[model samples]
Target chain A: MVAHATPKSNESKPIAALLVAAAVAIVGILIVVPLVSVFYEAFSRGVGGWWAALADDPDTRHAIWLSLTVAPVAVAINTVFGVAAAWLVARFRFPGRSLLISLFDVPFSVSPVVAGLALVLIFGRQGLLGPTLAWLDWKVIFSWPGLVLATTFVTLPLVVRELIPVMEAIGPEEEMAAVSLGASGWQVFTRVTLPNIRWALLHGIVLANARAMGEFGAVYVVSGHIAGATDTMPLRVEKLFQEYRQPASMAVASVLAGLALVTLVAKFVIERRLEAESRDLEAARGLENTRLEATRP
Target chain B: MSIHVRSISKSFGSFQALDDVSLDVAAGTLLALLGPSGSGKTTLLRIIAGLEFPDAGSIEEDGEDITERHARQREVGFVFQHYALFRHMSVFENVAFGLRVRKVPSAEVTTRVEELLRLVRLEGLGGRKPSQLSGGQRQRVALARALAIRPKILLLDEPFGALDAKVRVELRQWLRRLHDEIGMTSVFVTHDQEEAFELADEVVVMNHGKIEQQGTPDEVFDRPSTPFVMDFLGNVNVYHGRVENGRAFWHGIPIDYPAYPHAQSREARVYLRPHELEISPPGAVANRLGTSLAASIVRVTRSGPITRVACRPHGSEQELHVDVPTETARGLQITLEPGTHVAITPRNARVFIPGPEYSI
Candidate 1:
């Protein structure tokens, strides 16, 4: 006979209920409040006011274009350096390795203003290399290149950090096996190591690009906030706030929020792609196993 | 098809993994390098496969020195303990890897790969990946992949070590059959005495980075040249004793063997197999006059079709296990009861002087 069990009193439910209430309250205070406030401030004086600020504002348009354009270029440069650095750090053991790795994190630990100031000292007039650079008629401290240089410095660590752990987890045996099977070094890299590290590389690119777009202090010091040539979104946000163009600034902030949303969506897409690929691989393996089993008996 | 290894050695820091180890394998023979873990069996196999380079030695295949040859150029096949099958490829692709890498014609590759899959009894499972195969099937696929190139030397490092007991036995016999069918020069490394005895034409037993003894299976088992070989090859009973004028006295028991005329009179030990202990009737004149033990049966165990009894000698706690037929043990009715009289005579035993660190 099946036994009927008596239900215990609901003692654990109240603690869970209390945790749910507190969690809702925290989310409301931190996320909902600020988002609603930004909307309320941005759309004040009618929705037309925000629309006019976006469409008619030439400086705002320039800043948006500059930010969008430079971020990708900076990310592309950082990617090359990041991949080389990650591979070197992951695959080799050398003296001062820990120190070299520590240098990658300097941009994260040090202030962005310090990074900007350091670039200025090295590339500005009267700086150490500035005299030689001036003779060559090159502009670095107060140009678009200087802006990219500073932004790239601040965003360099993300991709390298993301790629290192993944690369290290993939041991050298697969590469050695490929080489032993008569594959050239390039063939080994393209066939074996690249496939293993593709997802990590994509994730790193997304993070580095996002950081490059939103870089503030370093770009502000280096860009001179030139309207057509150098002003990025974060700098534009500050410039509008200073010029009493609050609604326009909030509109641009909303654009940044939209970009962040796009990044989050891209991250979701990357994660979903990874899941789908692994699932397909597992299903293929399962199909093969079933075929083998069917033939066995 | 002939392999010549001369004065091969490797040292990692202070540890010498191999020290001037050398051997030869004639064409179309299976050589087994049998040793415990860390005795350089796998290292030697890797060196022959060109996966490893010896510090100061030369390796030759068919009278051509291949010491400086790359792994791919050496044309050697290797089956690892873990198979080392490419996880990303199907079984057909895996078996075809060596040939495809060498840029063979596609039609030839397909024909040769299918033949090997059939040879390893894995014909229709060609499209399946390594992860899809059972342990034994994966091992066979690895063997087929190694053999696809028709290598000069085929090397296996504990090929069946990672399988179930029944699978290991079945696959070992199958491997012997395949080796005979292929008639290729093959060397497989294994520490298992049964595998070495069953699969190899010549067995090389190694210890402490050196070859202890090497011979045919029967020669190594029946006539071990050293105490290490005797103890390692099978279970043995060692007794500290002295041999004087061809008569050895062990544990105050007289053991006379005229064949051991070269033994010194100083302190020595005699190695005797448990099966050599013949249980004659108590107080009966035996072929050899050893002291009779009024011992008590400790435990009894059934191994396969035979019964083994563990007993301790009277007035002493030294224990010995003897294997006997079930009928004999049942006839004797030996149990845990004390003061059970049993007489044992060792028919074939060896005498050796104990080295400084070998005996306790």
Candidate 2:
């Protein structure tokens, strides 16, 4: 004979299990499907062709080099402007503060295609100051300079948006303490303010760099996708796909995907490090509380 | 060095934070700005530290004008109530921060940093980050960091306000000893009367953005200048009264005023500290039974050696609590229960000219 069991009140086990399964299935379909397909296509191209695509191909080499070079430069430029803009928005009360913040919405609002087109119109031959640029024997559009500019514009908000909350959270007390300790403005910025925001700044850099490497539309229009000249990995993949070099395209695509994967892992590691540091800090504070309590008379 | 501030007043938009406050700090002495919240104690401290600008005032450090100087240029050391330790830096690094900012030699920084860490009793913890230290330890690191530069003045804004009761008392004692050892001209802001009394060489009592009075702790505590100061620094029983010649009268009741100033017959207020109120039987001979009012004991609280008896007058709506030696409460012979009859006689009450608001 089997005994009947009673279920507890307020415990909807069936619905909870169903919800968890549904959430997991949704994530698997949305992310895992395409990721697995991309990997299968890139690596399944016969060992000889895979090696050529990975190492021996000239176009692959150039695209990989261009990507490595341009992304870091774009991220570097954004870091400076981002820190400055974040500091202004966080620390100072000034006219147009709201307007300046709303400007960050510009990158997110406009489509990347529109951003590329806008860059073209401004720096193109018939655009404003186009004739002056031509007279100076310098070209702005359809060049590496144009690529960097467009990439920087699209990625500028990443660092600033990340840093604003961080800087605001730190407030002015730490810096003020440093100042009262005879630290100059620069010293305070470098020593006190910067260290507190370092994690946020690093997270922002990773995000900006990821976006820069994957950028296609703006860099495509601006660089003209010149073979072995301004062509980056993403542009090279597009070119290879157009040319029906399936194996080559997949190889370079895989490289780009691989870079993204590596950085994604890096981001996770840093996030974990930050979490551990915060937990350690909490534990230390707890210990302090206990010690204080113990020593109380 | 000595510092002088005269007539400092400041307004942020429409809120007046500091108003015409003046204070003078002698060389090599610690001063405490004591007040309740929003009484401008912190504002006055910040103004002297150059962290704030006064709308109207002048500041002089060692007879030299410094009102316009920036906080960094003022060459002062400040310890915040929260410690404000740089979390990323090690204890040694934090102590060396001010020196490093000044581009001191690396060797000199090492020596000074070590010396400061030892001074704060954190000799072995210099390698640990602030995130790794106890709150009390972090506060010491912050103090050491501030002192690393050896500024002409030291400033602390409620330095131990964040600590627990026991730690606060201990740190106050430690701070006093440190001050004596260093001979640094210092100013600290606090709202705790006990802390101010224990720590400051001189106490400045402030009220409503103005310096109500300033003197040694004993002088300020024993003889407060205004009704606000008397009410703020300790528990007091105030009475609405009038002064005529050298005598003070509450309603139609008169009391002998030996030290009462000769003033016109106008409405005045009298303040009597709780401990000054004596409990006596009816028709008992006492100092001066200004008014005999029957009161019933409402509550009794025993605090170690003292017993506080809270009573409400039988015919009036006012309630007063008087603290007496615990032994005295037992000797009363009668039950001091609720509705018990007792008389309250004012032993020493100071009179003041009444104000429009908060008169008595």
Candidate 3:
């Protein structure tokens, strides 16, 4: 009886199990093994070796600090830009709306190297606005500002893409209701619209922050790789690896991998919480409907 | 406060949503704007609420022009059809939102919110979020929130449209009772004729972005001013014919036309409610007093106390519906089974000159 208790779905159980095993093997070989190898190699020379490579080396410390500084600034600027762009695209219909939306997706499709090159063409020392900036004695390229500009350009679309669909689904009806109820324009937005899209906005910010922290290609092209000044963590890792300090290179690589892990965990927790909240809302709706039916005459 | 809307018109792109729409809401009365989809009922309601600006119109409240005022300054309570409760707010906070925005004292805000929660019959459910409320309860929360501001007039855009049929009826009765208790000037939009008839002191029937008829429920039902209103109001059998010398002729048969106003019109349309068309035995004596047409029963449907008989006129493909009491059908010894011969007599009918506007 137990053997014959297999349902229709059980017929494919062996194939499903085989496919899942294959997926797990691929991930172990491609991802888990490499991640473990990075940490193992970083600590191969013992903790003192890794600590001296990361903390004792002044250039390495400066590279870490520079990365930490650039990420938050890029994320902050892009967050504001993303929210405003999403609102404009989702809330109103105007000529060239489709063009504007397509332009928001440019950063997603374009190469980061190309994005950096475009920024250089506009803001480089010999570029279009170069003379004006030089006259003001404001240095952008080959500096921290250039690194931030490149990172922001590369990560700009993350929040806007996340928020546009959510805002469109929420619609203007709630905002209209608030306004009709004597709320000022700002009050309506803060009280009604923001709460509706807060989860999506937070998810976007998390992703944008991750991208801003991890972006290397555009920053490499813009930073000029000046040691102890403009060189970021990724550039430092490359430099250490080329100089035959394999352990030091792996140590820096391990830190970046750890940040990636933190981002993944945060994403997982946020997604789980969002799912639970929606499920709870659904359950509450069901309970209310049952109670309403029971109370009806 | 009374509201007077004068010559309101709104257009989007190439399509007109409202055309020369004018309406007046007396103080302490409920008016229903009843129309099919795309008939501008909701548009007019939004205009009155100041949620939308009319291309050409002025709105006056309490004898003061308020057309240019912002929605926040208009002091009109608007309830959206979807309830539009803030998803993240509790029912208590939703009802207290207007008061909070107005800087009401915390003590007074709590008291007022609690009072409104009691008024809307959600006294123990204040802590629950809107997502935790049923459709009817959410609508009540919306009403309570709107009333929190003590608006001069209340506007609801199909408030009961999202509920089940049973809930709709119950909410209709509850809304009527609430309006009676508070006596606020209220306007609601609905496409349900029965709801409009049963709930409102006045009914405005709209079609094609214009008001076709506006009157008391009985007046609109009994004496529709336009063919659109007549068709929209209830199921009616229409007969196409011509009027000449104060007589109407249809299908080679003379139809009685008493005091016909459109006697000179060559094209005429007569409307007869299903109930007004009486079915009798083929040779009944009552056929002598009215225009009787010979027909064979095509179908019969019995529901509750009424039996609807669908009959095909002799020598014609069109079918005319007649509603008779089951008791009367039995007393007359006339069975409404299919293929049974019967005579359909129009007990009362209204004639109108047929034109483009008459085409529903």
TM-score of 2: 0.89
Reference A-B contact fraction recovered by candidate 3: 0.62
lDDT of each: 0.79, 0.82, 0.86
Q: What TM-score would you give candidate 1 relative to the actual structure? A: 0.82
Q: Write the per-residue lDDT of candidate 3 for residues B215-287, one digit (tens) a residue.
A: 9999999889888888988799888888876667665556666656454668788788999888878985345
Candidate 3 docking classification: acceptable
For residue A61, give model 3's deviation from the true position in Å.
2.3
Q: For each model in turn, which proportion of the native inter-chain contacts is also found?
A: 0.13, 0.65, 0.62
Number of clashes in model 2?
A: 0
Model 2 residue A191 lDDT score: 87
Cα misplacement distance, residue B269 of candidate 1 (Å): 3.4
Instruction: Indicate the worst ten consecutive residues by lDDT in candidate 1 chain A.
Output: A1-10
Considering every candidate listed, which one attains the maximal lDDT?
3
For candidate 2, write residues A146-255 as lDDT tens digits. 88888898898999998897778667888888888888888888888887888888888998999999999888878888787889889999998999988788878877
Q: What is the lDDT of candidate 3?
A: 0.86
Best by TM-score: 3
Q: Select the stronger candidate by lDDT from 2 and 3.
A: 3
For residues A89-119, could you state the per-residue lDDT of candidate 1 as single tens digits? 9988888999999999999999999999999
Worst 10 residues of 1 chain B by lDDT: B285-294
Candidate 3 stretches greater than 4 Å from native: A1-18, A277-297, B250-265, B285-290, B333-336
